[model samples]
Each structure stands twice: as structure tokens, then as C-alpha cells.
Target: MISYSKIRTIAAEKKLMDIVIEKDYVLDWILWGISENDYLKYNLVFKGGTALHKMYFSDWRFSEDLDFTCIKPINVDKLREALILICKDVNNKSGMKIELKSIEASGDTKEDWSYEIKVEYLGPRQQSGGNLPTIILHITYYEPILYEPVKRTILKSYEDIPGDFFILTYPLEEIFAEKLRTVLYQRCYPKDVYDLWRLTKEVGD
Candidate 1:
């Protein structure tokens, strides 16, 4: 398995360690709150951007968001409220103006299945500090093929080394599928296209 220290060193070399460390602290805070409040069982699936893909042997461009998956259905409103309060509390403690933005449920999506939340800093572009220029948090739950709720399951994989790592990521095949769908249905980002190629090669190997 790739050593966590190695990952941290790589991030530090890339000037991303500060952001990484800050995000980890914030994530732990959220986890603690969720556990204390009996929110739901969840595991931190993803952390540092490149570290995520690195765990899967895929080449991914840098990203500034923290992605998580809930192992059970969460009360959307309650979760949002709690996150907002936590953000405020953290801001008060740190003197950093962090903003929590809730994306309304829409577009033929079923409730109690999956949703997204974003937490960002409010300031001038250059004024934003951390490894994350903009902090985007993604929270998704399990949904079956028929849009039915299902028990959230952890996705596990072995790192390139000889150890196991729980990867909070879609399967490489599914990722490719989504990439294709995005190219067909939305304006494609060049980096995304590059990522698809990189992932494809890695999976093939």
C-alpha cells in the first residue's frame, strides 16, 4: 500500500499539504458530530484528490474537493442544518468565513437515496487559502438499479502493494461509462478526457 506519509510528502511538495491537513481536520469534525448525533454510519471514502486515484492505480488530475459516502439514508434537511451549524462553529473557532451551500433536490431524483453538499470559503479568489482553492464536498448514498434505496456498501480494493484499502470510488468501468456519458451529454472538460484515458490505460494494465 502507498504509505500515508508518502502521500503527505507528495502533497507537501505540490504545495497542497496545508489544504489537505485542514480538510482532514474538518472531515474529522464532521464525523464526530455525525457519530455523536447518531446521524448515520458512514466511512470516509475519499480524501486528498490525487491520493484517491493513486489508491486505485489510476492517474487523476488534482482536485480540491472532499468526497464521502453514507452507509445509510440520511435526513437531508437535518444533515444540511447540522453541516451549516458546524461550518459556522468552525468558522467562529478559526476566524475563517466558510460557507455551506445546499443543493436543492431536483431533476427527477428520489429522496433518501443520494444528494450533494458543497462547502466553500467566501473571499476573493486569491484570498482563499488552503490546499483547496475551493472546497466542494460530495455526499452520495446507495441507490439500486430501480431507484430503490439499498444498504450502503463499501467498495474495497487492494492498493498496488500488498494491502487492502477501501476505495470510495465508482468502478473503473463505471467511471469510463460516466465519462462517455458526460462527453455525449455535457460540455467535456479537457482534463476529464485526459483522466478517462489515464484510467483506461491503468485498468487495462
Candidate 2:
């Protein structure tokens, strides 16, 4: 966990909301927790908008939730256990209070699972009377890996206390493909358009 003052200073420097800065720090700690969890380390491959920011490009938009594709189908009970333990480990190491509040299954089955893990934080922002913010983990099980998952280091912005940790994530090519899918088949989100354009600029048309 980053110091309250340090977090505030960052928010000021970036001209962003204080809570956003706090959430970013909490995100790092939570990912650090996942890094230490052996099951989550290999099973969950990080992806989506947050992955774009954390693994691929800086100057990308800040992301609110964590999206991961579980390589194998896992039951709710086992998933809950791993996540609860992760929150505990993070609290112990970072002195930041957090919990796996609930795991909600929107759709999907035991064979192909999708869960939303809400991690509520009693972080520095709580001092400012903001509601306890949650970091949502969108975990989808029984997903095929389109490309070879690569190990990537977290791109941290807050003050550094802990060292390096790596997680498996989609390569830039896979990310572009997925983002393009969203833009074409889904709602054509503004972020998708922006991301696709950025990717084109980075790797060429």
C-alpha cells in the first residue's frame, strides 16, 4: 500500500481524482497478491482494457476492473478459496484492508464459468468519505487461448515499495484481435476505436 500523502501527491500531479489514484495503488497490491498465489498465477491470464494499460501501453486510459480468462474451468468453491486467500495475503503484506466481498455468476455453467469477484477496499480514499471502492475481477473460465500467453511485468505509477512481479497476459497481437472483435461485433465502444487506432500507429496498418 502507498502512503496516503504520496497517493494524494500523485493525484495532484496527474490532475485526476484522488480515488482514481488510490484505486490504481490498490490494483497494484491486488495484482501482487495474485502473483504470489500459485494457482492464480498460471490459471488466470490477464486481459481486457486494464491489461492494455498495465502490460502493453502507457498513456492508455485508466481501467477500473481486472479481466482475466481462466485457462481451465474451475468451480465456484475453489475460485472463492483462492481469492479469499489472496485478499488475506494482500492485507497482511500491504497493510491495506480488503476482502473478497462476493462472487456473482452472471451467466455460464460449471463447465464454462464466469464470475465477478468484488474486492472492497478500506483504502486511503475512505478517509475522504468516498464509498468503499471495489476492484472487480471478471474471470471467465473454459476459454481458449488464441495466442501464446506471455509473461509481462506490471506498469506501476504510484510510489514503489514492493519489487517486480509478473503475470501471463495476451500479446499485443491478440489484444488487437480481441479489441477489434469488440469494435466490430460488440457495441463499437469508443475505447475500442481509440485502442485500434493506437495499435495501428504502434505496429502500422
Candidate 3:
């Protein structure tokens, strides 16, 4: 278990409030741990803005959710159960109030089924200074991963979060393509524009 004092120290060093640092730490830990869970093992490829922050780049923007693409079919009910258990384990291990709020599935056809899990972390309310923080994990299946040579990276322990796990990520070019598509098709997010600019500056057009 990570001590509150330790978390506080890290937060202070990063110039981030304790609640922000603590909630992020627990959510990151849970994501890493979920990748290694035994009951629910599959080829879950991480992606989206969080993937950029966690793997593809050095940008420090905070991401409140995890996005993944499953390389194979998944049992939604079983996955939900596993997540509930994982949340309990995270609560016990990290001394954070982690709860599995809900799991929602969507998609038009069998070729693309997406499951989004909403997790709530209730910290010391007084210390947090507001409502609980929520983390979302979105997993989509059957839509094949486009890019080959997926970058293999390791997620190392940070602050109070402990775990070293390998993460499979789409290449920079593919991530760039995804951001472009999002900008065109979906509600424009400022972060996507920012990411595109960064990609242009670093990786070039």
C-alpha cells in the first residue's frame, strides 16, 4: 500500500494537487494491473490520447481514461465481473476507494463491439476538495488493428503506483491517422488539434 504522505510528497514535487496526483496514480495502476489479470487475458492494444501520453510521446497532458482495441472477441459479462474484482483489489492494495460504476457496450454491428467501463475513485473527500474522480476504460473488439510492428513498451512504476507491464501501442503514423480521423468525424477536441501539431513538429507531415 502507498502511504498518503508519500503520495503527497510526489504531488508537491510535480506541482500538482494531491487529489489529482493520487487519483491518476490509482487509475494508471489499475490499467496496468488489468493488462496482467489472469481471469481475463487477451490481446488488448492500448490507444487514443492516453496512449500518446503514456507511450508514444513525452507530452505531459493528463488523460483521465484508457482506450484499447481488443485483437480478439471478448465476453462482456465476464469482462465486467473481472473489472469489478480488479477494482476491489485496487481498493484493497492502494487504500483508494475504487468502484466499478458501470460497463456499457455499443457498436452497430458484430464487427465492432465497444465496451466502456466507468470506474469511480472516492478519495478522502476533505483532502480531495471535491467529488470523486472517474476513470474510463474503453475496449473495442473485432475491428482489426491496422498497423503492423506495434510498438512494444513497458509501463514502469511511478509515484505510489507499482507495476511493470508491457503495453502494445500503435505506431506514431497510425496514431496520427487516428487523430486526423477524429478531427474530421467527431466533435473536435482541442487536445486532438494539439496532438496533431505536436506530431507535425516532431514526426513531420
**Top model number, lDDT:** 2
Candidate 1, residues 1-205, lDDT tens digits: the string is 2344654565576576554534443443333333333343333333223333443443345444555555555666777777777666655544445677555442344434555666665321224345433455666554222222222222222122222323344455545555666577875788667766776676574
TM-score: the better of candidates 1 and 2? 2
| Residue 63 error, candidate 1, Å | 1.3
RMSD of each: 8.3, 1.8, 2.9
Clashing pairs in 2: none
Candidate 2, residue 141: Cα displacement in angstroms equals 2.7
RMSD of 1: 8.3
Q: List the candidates ranked by lDDT, beginning with the highest.
A: 2, 3, 1
User: Which tens-of-lDDT digit does each residue in 1-205 have in candidate 2?
Assistant: 6677887898898898888988878888888889998878998899888888887776788888999988877668888898899999988888889988899886655666688889998886556465677899999875567899999988766555366789899888778887888788877878779888888787565
User: At residue 115, what lDDT does model 2 achieve?
Assistant: 88
TM-score of each: 0.49, 0.92, 0.81
Stretches of candidate 1 off by over 4 Å are 1-12, 15-54, 57-59, 66-74, 81-103, 108-116, 121-133, 139-167
Query: Candidate 3: lDDT of 100?
Result: 87
Compare candidates 2 and 3 on TM-score and give the better one: 2
Clashes of each: 1, 0, 0
